[model samples]
Target: MIEATNLAYRIEKDSMGERQIPETAYYGIQTLRATENFPISGIKPLPTYIDACVLIKKATAIANSELGCIPQEIANAIVQAADEVLAGALRDQFVVDIYQAGAGTSHHMNVNEVLANRALEIIGDSKGNYQKISPNDHVNYGQSTNDVIPTAIRIGGLLAIGKTLNPALASAIATLTTKADEFQDIIKSGRTHLQDAVPVRLGDTFGAWAQILSEHQQRIQTAATDLTKLGLGGSAAGTGMNTHPQYRQRVAEILAQLINQPLQPAPNMMAAMQSMAPFVNVSSAIRNLAQDCVKISHDLRLMDSGPKTGFKEIQLPPVQPGSSIMPGKYNPVMAEMTSMVCFQVMGYDSAIALAAQAGQLELNVMMPLIAYNLIHSIEILGNTLSALTRQCILGITANSDRCLAYAEGSLALVTALNPHIGYLNAANVAKESLATGKSLRQIVLEQQLMSEEQLAKVLDLEKMSTVNG
Candidate 1:
């Protein structure tokens, strides 16, 4: 390490040449160039992504050491450095922009340099002293950005799903299921094509939403299984050149223990490294979930539309004043926020799809974009859903009276008379009830379409709304 005369900066050299780096920065030359190169987005690398990279370094260090590829002392230092990072130290050192170089070379090197410097410090050496611990030759031995980045993305996604998204989804599903049971007795008008169609149990609506989320969870989990297959040993290309013969298996076993996931090497390392399909698959699953969430949010807003002029069949907990000036206004802000987040997730999914297909011969240069969007989508969605469940779903209360009134008033109630009075007669009763502003019972009774005894059995709202009734 060559410190500047002022002691504030140090000189670090790469293949292109040397530059003055801040003395305190753990990152070295290539990372410094990336920071200077890409300022498109002010966003830095996400912490989960950082954790993924660090875990990879730790696993690789152990594997390389065990294989006698790197000195045991050096590998021990590297492992200690990675452990410090994993424990949340030196986080701000990972400074590469999310929109940096193709195939994430810049950000990969950022991780490498930070670990190398930290390992140097562990060995009581000065930072930027690559001779003792080179980022490429020691810290990132037998690894390449092409393989490492994709593996990092996979691990990052699994971590996010296990730690964040899955739990949120499970919570939301549980809340919906409980609400379904709680609201089962409340009957409300069901709408199709924005027109009153029939009566349904409000509980069933929540139950249906729960089922939708459950299915989405299964799809996401299935997609996540693909993430367990890693291409870490593939190195620069699928060839696995320079890697120890046992490096791939040992690293997979090591990483599995670290992540607590059933990780394995891909049967086709080339395909794993080259294809962004796993990321895309997970992204598409998230997109599917987002679409339904948007619909569910819209349903919430619709059900809670107004106290006077709209449905108002359900009341969402008023979190804050919905309007700037309206004294009692309480918009469906939670639901609205959910829709917005889901929309963003959908957009990220689209970007991931395009990027998944944009790869060339042996690797996808678009991995960085996919990495950011996929992991970010999972995390933000997890966060949003958790908030939605806590702030909205759990606090919701059914407007039982309003729901009953809507169910009784809906002209679709005449449909029960169809089997007894025939379709044409039921249609006539519905039309007359609408024109006269009278209840379907009154119109049917006035027309004597059925006896009072028959109407009593046919028009029971509970039985009509009940499944299989």
Candidate 2:
């Protein structure tokens, strides 16, 4: 039972929080009071943020082990405490409210206190009794919030990319590949600028999707690689003032082993500490992906227009009535969802961009926002891809009849005759066919453009489509 003394905070505003879970996690003020005290980002802690916690834990273990920076007993306690966290424990006790200012000082302190409590628990003790393992002297040895928070962020971004975002991308790429293969034989009037220009197989268009996603996957992979370069051991502005010489590489090697990913020190600690450029590059790729998704959604909406007045070449599945009042109608729900997801990813990217740009001197002032936004991008992308595969890509089926009919009716078929008869003649025949409501065959035969042999030789739809293949 701790009282709120001069914790550098005194609440003056009404609070907003509900008590759904047990109050065992926090014994101080109500959640409402705590929230009113520290109001940063409204985001709760996600497992994506666990990388930071893990790094802090491992760093603490190293700091005491090699440097003899703190007492051996305290170091052992911190290690045992961190092991509890790694083994799935004490997640809630570290609940520092998200809004606390001072460059994530609350978060750092929360972690320290939680580890200290768990360390105490390991030796059969109660929480907050830091005597056995002082949170600062043991848990947070040889590090500051600057180093720990940033390191954790890098680890989280990399992990989210590897585990969630990468798989979603792979699935999306696979789906696109399948669509490209399926649509390969389907030739339609390919449009440029909302107007029909030439013939292209539907498969070719889908292939572009596959290839585009593949490109994004490449960029994402590259970005992931860049992110592997970390800023650990650069305690307090890259000078390593209080840290031992071997601390950086040793702890980093341990982290690499623990996370099963290659993590190395930044080649230039000064550059890394002063610049958020890597995140900027990554956020740019994320923005590109969002833009690509938006374009794809728009294309889908255009392709699967109306059954009565629009393109009608493709019919999207009718999942529900498009309008509440209208009985027979369908809307592009999947496409709209894709668009919304793209909008969200784009927004997150923008947040990252702004945050990255704000870095000055030795650190960026917006670390919390940076973590929140980048994580948002990763989560939105992961869920969006899942939705895309289940609701849109997998749900789609080609309208063979309509696709063929549109191909057959289009005057763009004049392309087949362009080789033998020339463009002007084909254009005239198309104009006559439209004028008299006659088929291209009727106009050709009546005007004596070519006989059966000549027409058959030149007007092969299969051959014409194969050129664009």
Candidate 3:
């Protein structure tokens, strides 16, 4: 066995070999080796994920204790240690990278070892004294990496979406709806294929955006319900081999109570254990939401394109300087940021989709990457929605004069006189206006196709913009 003295090391052995572990570390040799092996991403699993694992340990400890599977004292110690972890203690002990082993065995062992050592310390025993409390036999009593890791992923994903993303999206929809109401009186020319087609209220554009986000929120919530069905007691490959039959139901009930969400055991444990479809569904919903955000951000950028030569229909709140050399330039920074975040989330969706389909026979060995990407997507989207809502959507100011001018000048406005002067005359009016560099209104009045009062009634901006007017 390897040994050290100046830093106070402990000898920990595995089937592969023995190694020196730091005496002060709650994590043992497995975690230390994982840290060395998977030095890929500096990012660790999200804190919500760590908390979910700790909750699983606590629930298992209580369930095992109730079934007399372990000594009451050991179970009590495990529970206390898990509680400490939930309270955010010893977070540094979980040092494995998010890109580690596909089955998440490294992360599973990290949780087991940290809780085992901490329980030993709580019971007045030294760390690594597994004879008193073993990581496998005690802390991870009836669970397998297969069941625990997937269960923890669902738990963490649900929690992040519920507590972070859903609220942020709701706030964004509300902000958009508010802006929609504020801009109802502002008339503008609407474009189809980027060509002027008809008159539309600027408010209608914001209303459409709000409706899109509302639909996405509903889709995400519906998909999240699928996550409530868990595979926790399907030890190993869904055989439920080492677990009591009642263990699954008890654990589900306990977790539901603890998390305040109605969680239930999967109807088919084998299917649940073998499939990653639930994760795929959630990822698809997130991707759909991201796509909507991209469309919205691009529209905002176009609307706020320029103050001198572009559409300039609206002005975005200036968060920072847009250029180093351009003196008085401010960009739509928030919208641009939202677009980048959506693109990243879309990339995550592709990764999750591929990982979900990569499963073979009885288990998917890609849980670690799936979990990492799902959590990251949720967090980034939530932050993006919040930033877009507060910094851009809420602070936007409509350029009413510019909007009215564009509406009045658009050649497509000739369509409003189709019934009064007939389509042939209306087409000629539009063509002459474009060719002569004159406004549609000016051309119609100069041609005396209709009296000024009749033309005014036909080309009423507010009436043309209203639905079914």
Candidate 4:
């Protein structure tokens, strides 16, 4: 037993012993012990994840009541408590650290205890009176941490993708597509190996980014489809022990109705509880998207590099002063931030992958890590993309004069002349232009490789930059 030096307390007992829980707290002894045991990361369970667990409890309460596993009045109180939590009450009651106990038993108990205590209140009883509305006997009657945690992960992933990531991606793709159309007429120098090679439309660059993001969006959606398969009814070791015969299908059906998604029970309960492959698939998809986002962000930074000494072909909107030391310095801060967030998402993916493969014979003890990392990755990536779209992508402006200058001055213009003057002759002209500082047209005319009108027609920058021009 333990006591705070200066607070009102109530005594609660568990298998090991008894402890003094805060009188005002909805969580019971099990949760109090977990908070003491794991002071690891101060991070709490995510709200979306909390919602997932609460939704599960609500569905189970309904199922258990319907199947005569529990009294309907107790089920009503439990469901009422779940509704209150879903509507944003008792959020602070979930006090366990995200890194607690193998298989997230600590966090699971935290949820059960909170709802149980709250339900007690709704039924004219005080908190910690589990005898009347037991957290284990009623709230979590047909569930175990093994089954609950995995199902929570699936539900949380689906919710995050639907409510956050997908919408953000769609907005970003739309913004990039609009930019692509807006900049299509502007011609810029295209480079290979950091050296000028040919002319390209600035719009095509943005259009390609839009296409890449759209493709990634498709991949992520495809990956999320696997999350709909759940293992909710696989109580403790996947045997459906202590649960009603109809509990599995009934609870899944109720949860599907509550979440408004087509959630179905896994065909093999044990396999669903044992393997973390579905999470790995979604994490891998997010990682793939992050990799491409990093590339795109780098491209943006390079294109917006300098007003005096860099590409400066496009100007990212200046959201803030770039440096304290230098005035009038506006950096590509949004793109820079996008890259940083993407790198973090990639790191989370790695952690999730390791945790996914670390499962033992029956249950993976690393679920806490996987749950936190995967869902956090999705949420952060979505937020970063939304900010980038609104603050950077939408406000971008083209430097038409600079783009034209780069295009007109590039020695790659000789590329078009290759057909007219032969490859060797064109190479010689390019070499002369670089060495003598003469224009490609001037060098070509000096060599008399083609008529002036022919050179004019062949070496047109506007024609060369436009598609199929």
Candidate 5:
């Protein structure tokens, strides 16, 4: 029997025409089964997204150049076919089972086969004619499962940042920045352990939000940069055995150009091919970003808690009917969803760590699960940012009356008064205000702590919000 493993898994043009796989045929049915089988956390990675599309194309090209390892011509055929698919051709033929043992090797071949058949149609040849190109031989010459999966994932992560994550984060930060500038003078209560603690400007609160997101962006970007270290040069393991030495660099260069993303050879091909630590690092970065997101969302929801029943410092846009039966009721629905996304990202991170831990040498064959987890986390993060930007941040409007009201009554005002009157006296003023049903202003005035004019000037909101001032 001829071993086609080393050749690109291509179906060349034979006199006998080939058969086209139906969308509802074995492949599609298997995809369904595999998806169901990996229902570990109910996380279905968004394979239909642009990032996935670009990744498949780039990997296909890489596999084709490394064609001898699999099937060089098959790789070429897959590249040709996938290019068309990426260019808006042939949608149904790629229906394949996703739960193969060797990372996404089967899925990758399915793509090649589908594309090759589609390409044949483009050239007026019947489908399944194994004469010209096969999926394994031409398409996956020098590549192995160890190399292609990581490369696809890295590019996908980069694309997520460039196209999705950064845009949403920019909008969120922009909203907070604008609010910070606007509320620079608005003094309000700061809290520790959910208790009123000190005087703080509302603007300062927003400035902190902007800073957190900025820091998250930086951290995730760095982590994603680590992912750019490609395993393409590390065939099977790190030795590049059974592959041309130049094939590694050549494939990497070609893929980098094709994907329009800068990529470099992994410093240690062995490490890149052996374990899933890079994924763990990237997932950790995503989780960190998610944690920051949860913090912001929680704070915003608290600030907009209630007009009468709670401390209403800000107002959020009501996207849905918050209450099932209550009248005139609204909630921070977007914030709640954002919080959920953060939690999901955290879960994905844990999955990454666990999966990485299970890898034993020369390869981590848990490709299907690992890729799914990473891509799912990235997708949720992108969607969450979009939600926060459009449904929450942009929709948010200031509740000036509520803010001022809360500020007037808060014991936190005692902080500013303390600098002038001492902590004990300020505390007494706050305690007395609560007892007498009087505002902080009234207590201050009644206690003869300072003249009204002096209080007004010192209570200026803008001055409270400035960091340098």
Candidate 6:
């Protein structure tokens, strides 16, 4: 260790070369090299991922000590250090970039080094004293990056979906459901291929949106179940070469206790190590959800298009000024934002799918990319859904008069005369209404195709909008 002017450097070496790490950093040489090498994304790994890694370390320490694989003193110190991390300490210590070494070796080593150094401090030893508690020999006693990285990603992803995304989705669903009920009686002109169609209840449209999201929420929860099957004890090549026979089971139990989720070991370690299909499944579900979000946001944008020149059938809450030059102009900022997020999530799903397919025979080298993209999708979509619910969906106001006017004036209203007059006659009425710029009811009444009482019954907008048994 060398003390320079205002900056202290600790010398650390690996097979590649020697590097000086900051004396205050819990991370060591491997993490230093990773930061130097991968500056691609300019974003660090998420703190939730770090938390999952630390929890794995703590569980590993407890499991190893219980199995007599490490001394009690060392295990106790490591657990204490990892506990500090779990409590949100030393967050900046995990400094590796989101884009880093294959299989996330740099990330695994970064956590190991941090835990090792903190354990040293707990044992009254200075930092960088690998002799007292080596990152590999003690902190990573029975694990390999191949197993740890994927397991950590799964753990982190599941927690995020459960704690954040699921609730956000539920809130969105609730808001849409409420809107559906509120708009149940508001009949509007429905469009197909951007052309006027028969009338539909605005509530039915909102209910359909809610149903789509509810299905997505269920799919996400189901896919997350597969994440709980972990590949923890499969060392470098999924052979469990160095770990004890009971290490995997013991670690799963400890992890279940720690996270309050019942994690279990994979039935076949080799299959688990070589395949990332579970993650791909979850990503596919997220992609489906993103697709739905894009549709809903686009629909909202179209419905709220203009106060003067566009549909203007519904009004979104004005959250911000949409333009710099236009006065009193409020855009559908939340809907646009949600659409952009959904597009990004779709891109991430593609990346995740490609990464999942690139796995080789023994181990997948694209775990780091998978972890980064999966967690990012979950976090951003969660936040976006929450914002869409509160800032946009919940505050939407229907232009009932506009909706009624559109419904009353639409040529499609001629369809109601089909049962009474006939399809050909109704078609003529629609064509004549369009040609003369007269309403369908006006054309029918002027032509005397039906009596006034019969026309009123045939043109009952509310009954036309209602679903027939």
For each candidate in turn, give its C-alpha RMSD to the true structure in angstroms: 2.1, 5.2, 2.2, 1.6, 6.0, 2.0
| Candidate 1 per-residue lDDT over residues 1-469, each given as its tens digit | 2223455888999999999888888999998889888978878999999999999999999999999999999999999999999999999888888998999999999999999999999999999999999999999999999999999999999999999999999999999999999999999999999898789999999999999999999999999999999999999999999999999999999999999999999998999999998999999999999999999999999999987889999999999998888888889999999999999999999999999999999989999999999999999999999999999999999999999988888888888999999999999888888888988888788888889999999999888898883
Clashing pairs in 3: none
| Model 3: lowest-lDDT 10 consecutive positions | 1-10
Screening candidate 4 with a backbone cut-off below 3 angstroms (N, C-alpha, C), the clashing residue pairs are none
Which ranges in model 1 have alpha carbons more than 4 Å from their true place?
A: 1-7
Worst window of 10 by summed lDDT in candidate 6: 1-10
lDDT of 2 by residue, 43-126 (tens): 566666754576557665855586677766666777776776777776655555544553465666667666765676677775
Model 3 C-alpha lDDT per residue in residues 368-428, reported as the tens digit of each score: 9998899889988998999899888989999999999888778788888999889999999
Candidate 5: clashing residue pairs, number: 57
Residue pairs of candidate 2 with colliding backbone atoms: 39-99, 40-99, 52-152, 183-203, 184-203
Give the TM-score of each candidate: 0.98, 0.85, 0.96, 0.97, 0.82, 0.96
Error of 2 at 189 (Å): 2.8
Candidate 5 matches the true fold with a TM-score of: 0.82
The global C-alpha lDDT for each of the candidates, from Candidate 1 onward, is: 0.94, 0.71, 0.90, 0.93, 0.68, 0.91
- lDDT score, candidate 6: 0.91
Error of 5 at 163 (Å): 1.9
TM-score, structure 3 vs. true: 0.96
Q: Which stretches of candidate 5 lie over 4 Å from their true place?
A: 1-45, 48-77, 96-102, 122-124, 417-433, 436-465
Top lDDT prediction, candidate number: 1
- Report the lDDT tens digits of candidate 6 across residue range 121-232: 9999988888889899999998999999989988999878977899999999999999999999999999989998889999999999999999999999899898999999
**What lDDT tens digits, residue by residue, belong to model 4 across residues 1-469?**
1235548889999999998888988989998899889988789999999999999999999999999999999999999999999999999889888987889999999999999999999999999998999999999998899999999999999999989999999999999999999999999999999899799999999999999999999999899888988888899999999999999999999999998898899999999999999999999999999999999999999999988999999999999999999999998999999999999999999998888889899899999999999899999999999999999999999999999899999999889987887899889988999999999888778778889999889987778877762
How far residue 273's Cα lies from its native spot in candidate 2, in Å, is 1.6
